[model samples]
Structure formats: structure tokens, C-alpha cells
Target: MPDLALDIAFAWATLLLFGGGLLLLRARDAMHRILALDVLVSIVVAQLTILSYSRDVSYYIDAALALALLSFTATLVVARYVTRGRPF
Candidate 1:
């Protein structure tokens, strides 16, 4: 059923989240670290979406939206800073 599928997806997302964290920690360069962080945020967003569906809560989706927007803006700023030595 769909519930079982969602559970599987949630487990995968959790594993990915931990893997992303490891990648972020192991990255030796600024760009690599930035990319890892973005990946982590994306995984978190996916997990949040799964939670929203499974729990039937609207707020989780809203929070996920806000998080995604913030992550995107932050990634843009950080990427600029890493390449240009300044964020603006």
C-alpha cells in the first residue's frame, strides 16, 4: 500500500540525511561543503514532505516550503561568497 511505500521512502530519506551530514563533514573544499549542505537540506525537505503526507498535517508542508526557500537563498549567498569572497 501507499503507507508502506511512504515508510520505505522515509527510511531512505533518513539514511540519506545521515550520509549528507557525513559528506558535509568530510568535504575539504568550500564548494564541496556548500554542495553537501544543499543536499542535506533537500533531503530534509523530502522527509518533511513525507511526514506531512503520513501525518495529515498541513503545517509540515508549510514548514518544508519555508525551509526550501531559505535553503535556496542561503545556498545562493554562500555560493557567491565562496567564489567571489563576498556575499551580497
Candidate 2:
């Protein structure tokens, strides 16, 4: 029963990730695309956290953290570029 629940949760997460990816690709405006990308990154982090919980692995958490940091930095760079025309 527990395993079945986990499977269902994972399935939902996968669907959300797919949807977010599609949204990111379909966005017409730069701001909308940035928001969609953030959503996609968030979904990836959630999936990683769920995997870590189900598999009893710590490395997944570490990987998720690293991904989050990268996402944050990228977002900042992009925001800067969008506002000021330069990322660095």
C-alpha cells in the first residue's frame, strides 16, 4: 500500500514536471518564460526530494541543493540581463 502511494506521487510529480517544461517552451514573453523556468526548476527539486525520501539516499538531497543554487544564480543572471542588458 505504501509503495503504491509512492508510485502515484511520483507519477503526479512526473506529470507536473512535463507540464512545466511545456509551459516554459510555450511562453511568449521573456518574463513569462523566466517564471516558467523557475517552476520547472522547482518541480525538479521536488522530484529529487521525493526520490531521496523513497530511496533513503542523502546524495539526492545534496544534488537537489546544488541544482537549487544553480537555478537561483541563473535566475539572478537572467534577471540582470533582462533589466540592464548585461548579466555580468
Candidate 3:
């Protein structure tokens, strides 16, 4: 059923978020940790978007946009820190 598939998707997304968190903890290098952190954030955003669709809530969409902006800034800052140079 379509509902079952949606539920499965949600479960899978949660697993992905958990796995990313573990990766972030286990990752040794700064770059790898940053990538894992980004993946975790992306998974959370995906979950929020899916919930928004299911509930027909416009507020979650706004939350997704805010997450995107903050994640982008975080990535940039982490990249600069990891590379020790400006990203151009």
C-alpha cells in the first residue's frame, strides 16, 4: 500500500540520520566529519519535508529552508577551517 511505502521511507530516513550521526562520531578527519554532519542534517531536512507533505503543513517547509541556509553556512565555515584557506 502507498501508506506502507511512506512509512518505510520515513523509517529509512531515520536510520540514515542515525547512521550519519555514528559516522560523525567515528570519523577521524575534520573533512570527513563535516561531510557526515552535513549528511545528517540533510537527512533531518528530508524527514521534515516528508512530514510536511503528509501533514500539509506550510511551517515545516519554512523550517526546511532555514535548515538549508544554516547547513550551507556551516559547510562553508567547516571547509575553510579544514582547508585553512578561503574558499573561492
Best by lDDT: 1
| TM-score for each model | 0.97, 0.89, 0.89
Once fitted onto the true fold, the runs of candidate 1 whose alpha carbons sit more than 4 angstroms away are none
Kindly give the stretch of ten consecutive residues in candidate 2 with the minimal lDDT sum: 1-10
- lDDT per prediction? 0.95, 0.90, 0.88
Off by over 4 Å in 2: none
lDDT of 1 by residue, 1-85 (tens): 9999999999999999999999999999999998999999999999999999999999999999999999999999999998889
Clashing pairs in model 3, backbone N/Cα/C closer than 3 A = none
lDDT for model 2 comes to: 0.90
Residue 83's lDDT in candidate 3: 96
Q: TM-score of the candidate numbered 1?
A: 0.97
Model 2, 9-82: lDDT tens digits are 88998999899889988999888898899888988898898899899999999999999999999999998899
